[model samples]
Target: MDELIARVSAAIGVDAGVARTAIGHVLAFLRKELPDGPVAEFMNQMAGAHQAADEASAGGESAGGLLGGLLSGGLMGLATKLNALGLDMGQIQKLGHEVFGYAEGVLGKEKVREIANSVPGLSQFL
Candidate 1:
């Protein structure tokens, strides 16, 4: 995943370090924006939903379950909000993917997801 993120970031011509910081910010924003269902919730969601994904990959359940859950649960709300504001889920997903993809490229999505998901009161940011 680290290599993948780096590969993608390099393809996009962004400073890997800057991309990492941007990912940190995006993770923070996700927490702040979805205070009620922030990173912590995402962490649990990821942990809880691990089995539904493929087990053969090296990234394993935490990446699939925890990170995937966070994306589905937390970002789902974001999609709805954007839709309410005259954007569609596709646009929201695109914007989120761009933002998060950069971040993942920098720091690796799981790393950012783990740290961000551990904080308390992240929901307060919403």
Candidate 2:
């Protein structure tokens, strides 16, 4: 995860610490946004969201449809984290772009797009 943070930082020319903090905020926000469930549950939610998008896009092209499940309900939590961290929306957006781009590089554009579309701030990258 730290390596992922570092790569994202490099990609977007942000400090590694900033990238790490931003991602930590995202994960923590996800945990808080989810119902009282295991971490695996959130992971499952993310995957299911992606698969749904893949299926929907098979017949026609779409932009953020693949991201719906991810961005469904976590925005407020993510915003709270950013507020606590003293990062404004622009910072959060920049971090999101870097992280999403790096994720895409690793998981392939489609898979990453699917994942990004599901998450809160990440959906903007779409």
Candidate 3:
């Protein structure tokens, strides 16, 4: 998890804290949008991911804004949530690539592809 956070931080040019929060938001969004099986597999494979997802689920800076209320599901909502964490679209895409790349290293390409494909409009991020 720390490796992933570091990679995202360095690659996205954000601090560790911001990268972590963004990761939490993305994981939480996936938990909400994906089926139980794939999400469970991902959570199990990724250490500390459950904690991050839980934190995001509990709500924080990203959940309270007016835009947060307006966007509730799918990729648009995920983008909105991430944007609240101070990432632009390019950074968001880079974050996704780094995260999915990390996931592929841990969980394999097929698993990551399955997870990404399950969500509509998510392929663009990959």
* Strongest candidate by TM-score: 3
1-126 per-residue lDDT for model 3 (tens digits)? 899999999999999989988998888888888748766787788889989988876774446477786775678877888887889999999999998888788778788888888987787766
Candidate 3: worst-modelled 10 consecutive residues by lDDT: 57-66
Against the true structure, what is each candidate's TM-score? 0.32, 0.52, 0.91
| Model 2, C-alpha of 115: deviation from truth (Å) | 1.7
Model 3 residue pairs with clashes = none
The TM-score of candidate 3 is 0.91
For model 1, residues 66-89, the per-residue Cα lDDT tens digits are 544345334453333334334444
Per-residue CA lDDT of model 2 for 6-68, tens digit only, reads: 665775566866556556555544444442433334334343333322332332123223343
lDDT of every model, 2 decimals: 0.40, 0.51, 0.83
Question: Which residue pairs show collisions in model 2?
Answer: 67-117, 67-118, 70-118, 70-119, 71-118
Q: Which stretches of candidate 1 lie over 4 Å from their true place?
A: 1-29, 33-76, 112-126
Clashing pairs in 1: 23-103, 32-126, 35-123, 46-65, 46-66
Best of the two (2, 3) by TM-score: 3
TM-score winner, 1 or 3 = 3
- Arrange candidates, best lDDT first: 3, 2, 1
Number of the top candidate by lDDT?
3
Provide the lDDT at 36 for model 3.
Answer: 83
